[model samples]
Target: MGSIKPAKSLLYLAISMVIGGTLLNVNELAYLAVFPLILLAMGLFVEPPSGIKIERIVEEKTYIPGDEVTIRVKVMIERGMGMVLLRQPLPPEVELVKGNNAWSLFKGPRKLEKELTFSIKVPRRGLYTLPPAELYIEPLLKLGKPGTAFLGNPVTITVLPLIKPPRRVRTTNTRSQIPIPLTSYSLTGPISTDFKEIRDYRPGDPVKFINWKATARRGNVLVNEYEREGKKTVMFYVDARPTMSVGTFQENPLEHAVSLVASLAYYFLRRGYNVGLYIVGRGELMMPSTGNRQLYAMVKKLMEVEVLSSANEDFKDAMRKSERIIIQYTPLIIVVSNLLQANELREAFRLLMKHYKGRVPSIVFDLFPYSMFSGKKVELVRLRKIAIERELKAISHVVHWDIRKTEISAVLAKTIRMVR
Candidate 1:
């Protein structure tokens, strides 16, 4: 706040003139300079700006790498007359596409409103928070101290991974049969003849759902759990460990894998399949559901997904909790990750194979981030990749994706064996 008067250039000039006029005995010049000092002193009565407010408005927020977002930042300075300076600090990863983040303007009297509009391109995936707006108001006459204020509300943007539509290559009347053990089971749902497990009857159990045979054998009342059709669920297991951070942050293996997951989720959800996601980092399952809302939920979670700094992920625990869902929906499994030198990834596959009873038609979008690196071992990585492919091929349809050489869509087109 500008609560005290500070001597300005005009005050100093007037003092110098009076001192000179005393030595020279010239009253007219000193009196004229005194008028300037009096006017400058009147500026101290002007209050510094207060009631400063800032608001951020975003338009058509398309959150993905390389996508531009238009941001409109408005500032309302309601109190003092001054020169206004407003600044909105952006993260280093965000690039300005147009306009400016900082602007300076002259302000006068009551309610001065200003707008700083710009377009920015976010270059990576993560949760980004733009710092609070900073406002500096200096007196219009430059005769008093300036005032500063900050609006503490920050703007947070979650940049989700980009999804590229897979190239569709449809075949007629032919399905690829691979060698894998297959089994069938059922879990809870409505309107299907498939029998789920039998359990002791609860109060709400219908008489029709009673398993008389099991009741007779166990000597206890039992009711059958049910399964249904007309709705399907696809569960995605995204491996987001630091290993997926193989290339540059923007073009790394994890980024592409996340995008692949998003695209697959979108594709299946668009067809009315109830979709779910299990991010390996946090190991939380997004329950399966169908709709624009489900897709929104999945993408929103995916936007917050990042390659964790620690590798201590619990894949088995995450899977165990999701086992009932796996059995209930008999969902087609899609595991997205970079498998090179990843022992955890291999273990995850072995664990997953047991669930859908080795028959959960699964797809592994295996990332090849070898060539993206520079070293003599690039060739060695390529060799080891083949061995890993053999292991994955035993249980799932493997799409070998070379990030340095190809896009995810192309690999899917060539090797996509969609189970649903």
Candidate 2:
């Protein structure tokens, strides 16, 4: 059963009873009957309000972390009521003004209406769901509280990922140039282009590569010309270690490194170099591949790769596999990392050098903040950082980049100096 307005109706009924009883005792039965009838009529006649409309408006659909955003809720009552209370429901993560609930009260005659607005700051980056508003109303008697009805469509707001320039960013060692579109043949080993058919030596044939069997048939010496393949396989090794954290919360230096990796991967992939990425961390190994599929794979991996102090030996083994596959082919190896261990650097460079017979060149990128911490503000720390940078530079071809001083582009431009 619906709530009865016992208190309100009883109050008026009591007053009417006093006056009616007094008059009735004086034989005024007509007024006594009329008072009770009026009280009963009001109790039975009060109708509930309806036709309320509620809508929410957000300032923007997409927002990054630390952005000031506003959300406004508009409520309109189409019909009037005795007393109506509107309670707006907000997401739990959002904080309302003064720590109060989002609610509004309206009280007046029939056809009475109003609208209310509530705004709050978005706290973090994620999608938020907005709850509906609750509409409450009551009739003549205030015996109990108001009746409630939830109305309004659910709304959504998407908070995008935070993007900022890195304070200390590292650039890779590989310098890429567009290869000429010539039919590049394999130069090393039993490859198709390296082996030219044996022919009878012509008058101008070089004596070093001439085949005697073919020369006997034609009675002349034949020459062998080796073709050089234009394709260059550039492998990028990213050292995603825990000690390399460069920036504050929400903005990480690793993101800068990932961005650089992504851009370079795209750049190399476009230049027709089979680009591969190896992230030295937990369970993350993106083998060498090509095209948009491979790029997407790399980006997805970078998106989820976490930093660790040390990677599994499986990663190094994977690198060994890559080394073997491209032993006769890969001319350049680019390892991007914040150089920490001298022994690790020595061993990794040693392995690559062994494959190339001291001919293959490797670049190690030491990503760290060397300049900001170098001042007198922290003299000892500066000295230690400089010492490490110099040590790494001395051991291998290292590109030292100060992420705080410049962006990745500027650092990348200066990378040529390291090789020179």
Candidate 3:
């Protein structure tokens, strides 16, 4: 049941009756009091609205950051009575991109249903749920309080990271070029031991490589020739320890590191290189494969990385575990981290050097914690900067990058230059 509130018309009638009874004839104004009493009784006994159905529909359930989603709400009333108001509260992760969230409608005899539509833009990546909507009904004649009812079911939306195409970089080694038509498995470059065909010997051809059997048949000097296969293996190690979480939600070291790893993985995989990912965080996540499938797997894993409050031994353990694999394949290893501690950085470099012995082209990308230095004392900042610099310099081949200062393309370009 809806409660009653004294209307302005009722208040006006009450005042007129009092003045008329006091200053004029009391009997003449006595009839005016009945009008206000009748209005009050009607408002007090007004029944609340019931038998309403609400349905909600969303345009899409999955999207990337900055995608606009439309939500449509339909409200149907079995019996039309009084004025109804509808409101839907938006999730914190999204902002109202367009349209109104609240709708007020008068339920007349001819009208039994109403529809409300709105749009929201998701600004970040994660899973979010839309809250239920609310419905309020006011008494007839605009004289009573409003009664509320919850209207729609909740909806979940998963927002993936925004992936932009990486800039093309020319590889330093001409042998690294991808073939026009890719094969399942092939050698990266020509080797004298892996001969393919025999051709007429050139003037400068080495004697050891000349095939005696071919020369005996043709009576001409024929040299063994080999075809260079363009296939390489690359491994990316992303540091997800607690120290990498130093920054605001909008810009953090860990997020930048994730993006870097994703871009590089995509870049190498497009060039027909077998790519592997090892995330060092709460638990090690490894996806050792190649092609588009491996790239998607790495992206999915990278999207789920979160900041932890405590440190884990996964980073050190992962490096140790990867030692044998690195030595066997001699794949290019790229370690992306903040290098916050001197001891940890030294240990990682030592492990890589011990196993590969500089045979593998390794790169250490130092994600400088520049954003974390904001609002700090000058002396403290200087000390921290010096410490980071010293730790990075201790490593043999380190690339220092500040995400806040430049874009990921520039960083990739720098890596390409270093490779050359």
Candidates in order: C-alpha RMSD to true structure: 5.8, 9.1, 8.5
Q: Assess every candidate by TM-score.
A: 0.79, 0.54, 0.68
* Clash pairs, model 1 backbone: none
**Candidate 1 Cα outliers beyond 4 Å, as residue runs:** 1-9, 19-28, 109-111, 140-142, 176-230, 314-317, 341-360, 415-417
Better of 1 and 3 by lDDT: 1
> What does the lDDT come to for candidate 1?
0.74
Per-residue lDDT tens digits for candidate 2, residues 1-420, read 344546455657766767776866854643565666665555566555567777878776556545655666666666534566666666777556433335645544555445455566555445667778777777545434457888888887765444332232345634333121222212353433456466555676557777766767776666665555446555677767765565543445565566566666666566566666777655455556567787667666665565776655433554665665446455455666665556666666556655543434556666665454445755564556567667766545666655666677765544433322
TM-score of 1: 0.79
User: For model 3, where is the 10-residue window of minimal lDDT?
Assistant: 176-185
lDDT of 1 by residue, 41-110 (tens): 6676776667778899876466777878788888777887778788888988888889988888776766
The parts of candidate 3 lying over 4 Å away from their true place are: 1-47, 55-57, 61-63, 66-70, 139-147, 171-231, 321-330, 352-360, 371-396, 417-420
Give the Å error, residue 86, model 3. 2.9
Q: Candidate 3, overall lDDT?
A: 0.70
Better structure of 1 and 2 per lDDT: 1
- List lDDT for all candidates, in order: 0.74, 0.58, 0.70
Rate residue 112 of model 3 by lDDT. 78
lDDT for model 2, please.
0.58
Runs in model 2 deviating more than 4 A are 1-231, 309-318, 321-331, 370-378, 416-420
Tens digit of per-residue lDDT, candidate 3, span 51-157: 78888888765587778988888888765357888888887767898899898877755537777789988776666687887888976676766678886678777
